[model samples]
Target: MSIPSFLKLVEIQTKVASVIPFLLGTAYTLYRFNSFDLKNFILMFISLIAFDMAVTATNNFYDYKNAKKTYGYNYEIHNVIVRSNLKEKTVLGVIFTLVLVAVICGFILFLNTNVFVLILGGISFVVGLTYSAGPIPISRTPLGETFSGIFMGFVIVFISVYIHIYDENIVKLIYNNGILDISIDIIEIIYIFLISLPAVNGIANIMLANNICDIEDDIENRRYTLPIHIGKENALKLFKVLYYAIYIDLIILVIIKILPIYSLFVLLTIMPVINNIQEFNKKQTKKDTFVLAVKNFVIINIVHVISLGIGAFS
Candidate 1:
């Protein structure tokens, strides 16, 4: 397949979902620990991107294979594989190559860091691999938001911070005389989780928005996504709630002094986010208002990242 087809196969445009959280994690690590590990960060970035692409490609491949209806658009126009008439073998080959690259980089990162990295990364890999490929794909279940939000949003940010402080005793597993002892710093973990809420909410909202818009098509395709299980009205309520939760989380962070006062500037995103939420509530068209979810995510997280970066320096 050509480069453009390859990109579409992987849904490259959706990668911002992963990139923003990675940046948030990095910025928080710098702000809180005042430490930076260029080598580990680069390795993690490569692995993260590769795995994300692989997951997206796998999702598309499976969707193409399982789709029962084309909605209003032809598969030839909507799916890169059908559109390009690319061989399934070629698409699988690309997916394997991307996964192999991700695994290699992850192994290198593990060698440089510790077992926690391996453990967490392994879990993420398994989840991503199965998200769209197994007998029961996560995307086809009501738990998609929970898994995507926690794993992609919170876990990625946590790992990003942890990689920079692998030796700092935030979390540790020690083996002594054939016994494994696990220790965790609860306070630090809580802070990390709290800081990660915005990302979790944003990512979950993206999936929720997509499901909301695709409810009819998903049902026709037998996908049974969260929106279908919960009904569109409830799902839209959740979409709005998640966005509002971001601001509340940020405010709490600032009040607790976990986040710098500068981070409060992220509040400026509220008006635009609210506007987008209102727009989405008015209409749930995939071609039109679905973009509002993404716009809200970008508006909130970009400002949050920049605010954290400024805090890191000042």
Candidate 2:
């Protein structure tokens, strides 16, 4: 396959969904812990981006394989496999190669970090694999948004921060005489959760937007996504709610001093994001309005990460 076909197969443009959150977590770690580990940072970046690519490739591969309609929008234009006339074995080769790279990098990260890295990395690996490849793929179910948001949003952020502060006693495991004990600092975990909300909301809205646009197509394909289950009206409402919820979470974070007062400047970008949301509310089409969700995500999180940087640096 050519480079363009391969990039399309992996949906490389969508990798920003993961990349932004990774930056958010890194910024938060710097702000909260006042420490940085370049080694682990590099490892996490390679692992996270590789896994994200692998998961996207896997999803596309499965989607093409299982699609019911063979001559329409999805088959002809949307799916790269069908569009590019790529061989199945070649696609599988690309997917497996990406996954192998991700796992190796993640394992190296775990060896340098702690048992929590191993445990959480394992969970993320399972979730990413099962998200689009299993008999009952998560993307085909109503839980797609929730799972994607929590894992890509909260879990990635938490793991990013944790790797930097693994020796901080926030969460620890002790094993002796075949018995194990675990400890956690609830306050710190709560802070991390609050800080993760913007990314969570943004990522969830992206998935919701995609589902909303693809509802008819998805239903015809026997993929009962969230929008199909809840109806588009309610799904749009949920999308609006999730976007607005980011500001509320930001307010709480600022009030608690989890984020610097400078971070409140992110509120200035809200109008543009709201505008995008209204446009999306007006029309929900994959080629037309789906990008509004991505625009909103970028509007919110870019300012968010910049605010974090200002807070950390000053």
Candidate 3:
């Protein structure tokens, strides 16, 4: 692949879509908690970007392989599959293997060999790989939304937090450092979880919208994704549910003081969400509106992170 073609194959836009929220969440944790160990954070961030790129490359490989088999070498799935210097499957497999090794080494270097981290890493690896590969790809199931919500939202958030704060002596460290000026209580953990909820839901809905756009192709390939299983109209309703639930949860957290009242800055995301919702309602073709909605979704996450960072720092 030429330089421009290689850049296109990486799909920088999609990468930003997947990575910005994780970056925001990581930044927020460091900023609010003052857990700014730059070296470890950089390692974790690199591992995360690698994992994301590898998974995306794997998905592209799978789609390309299947398209080839079905269409006898027609490049109908160019948007889904990146054309490149190497065979898609070979490229994906090599990237996935190398990234998996890097992620393991990264944990060993930056985190202790605790059971929690090990278990979470195993779960994340399985979910991430099976999302686009394996006999029972999660992306092909009715549980796509549910699986994505858990993995991208809860699991990723927990793992990122754990990576940053997973020493056996973390409580002692926090107490000694005088970070947050509070005890390492259940309330703090719950608060972090609450704050992560909006970003999680936003990401899950974004995936749902993307899957909905590809529903026809998925159905033709015998992949029964959530959007196909639920019907597009119902999927739209679920999208609304996901969007509203995040804000509702944020409000509840603020009301109960689990999140600071100033965290209402997150509500600024409402405008983008509403705008995307309106565009989704008006647009007929999934291809026509899918990219627009995804762009708005990325903006929403970016705004959410910025808002939360400001509130936390202020």
Candidate 4:
């Protein structure tokens, strides 16, 4: 592929969306331990990139096929389908094969047949494929948002942490280091909670927004997404609940000292979240607001990683 074609095929925006979570997990792992095996880190990074690309390709292929069956080869769906000229079956098969190979290589090079690593990797692979391609794609169900959040939030975070910190030596280090003993436990729990909060909220909000935009289309397609199931006003209320709950959770974590007081620096992310909420409240189109929500989520994750690094290492 030509440079421009290759870039378009991979879809830089989609790649960034995939990379943000991995980056957050990596940064958190490095912060907690203050060190990483460079070779393993590089391998994991490559595997993540490959995983993202394969999933993107697979989702686009499946969505395109579904859209074509319903909409009759419309250009609107064509534009959204990556590598649109390729046959859907061929694209799906190729991407799935590539992802399986990548996972195998990842396990061999970085994970060494560890059970936790295998389980996490298997879950990720299954979720990524079944998300859009299964007989009952999770994206089409009422539980779509919940699944997205958990996969992106706790599962990904836990996998990244496990890969980086689960070696015998690291376990021994954490056990022996008196200062880290209490802090590590607290941080791990808090991190899991906080990470899930934004992930769940952000993903739910995104799906809600998309459903709102495509309500007519989605209904016609027989997809019962959250917005369609809950209605618009109720969905907005759900968004508010999700939004406020995240902040409330953060505050509680801070009070309990599960999260470092310094990690309050993540409060800076609240500004964008507030702005997005206000826009949503004003009944603004969610398409206009989606970028803001994503920005806020990314900033919060970055700030959390930074604060954890500073508090743990300093």
lDDT of 4 by residue, 1-314 (tens): 34444344445465545465666666666655555666666666677778777776666666666653345322243334443454555555657666876786678754442555665677787887788778888877777778777776666666566666666332232235455342235546556657546555665566566566556666767777888888878877787677677777767767876566777887777777777777766763434555655665667666766776676666
Residue pairs of candidate 3 with colliding backbone atoms: none
Query: How many pairs collide in each candidate, listed in order?
Result: 0, 0, 0, 0
Q: After superposition, which runs of candidate 3 have C-alpha atoms over 4 Å from their true positions?
A: 3-5, 68-77, 80-90, 93-101, 109-115, 168-189, 284-286
The true-structure Cα RMSD of candidate 1 reads 1.0
Error of 4 at 17 (Å): 3.8
- Give the TM-score (vs. native) of candidate 2: 0.98
Q: Tens digit of lDDT per residue, candidate 1, span 158-224?
A: 9999999999999999999999999999999999988888889999999999889888888888888
TM-scores for the candidates: 0.98, 0.98, 0.82, 0.80
Give per-residue CA lDDT, model 3, range 1-314, as digits (tens).
35554444455567664466566657566655655455655665666667777777677667666652354222343544433446555575556575776587657734543446565666777788888899877777888777776677666665566566665333333224555332345655566667677666776776788777777667777778888877989988888788888778978977986555656776887877788787886763554777765666676667666665666677
The 10 consecutive residues of candidate 2 with the worst lDDT sum are: 67-76
Using TM-score, rank the candidates from best to worst: 2, 1, 3, 4
Using TM-score as the measure, name the better of candidate 1 and candidate 3.
1
Of 2 and 4, the candidate ahead on TM-score is 2
Candidate 4 residue 286 Cα shift, in angstroms, is 6.9
lDDT at 32, model 2: 76
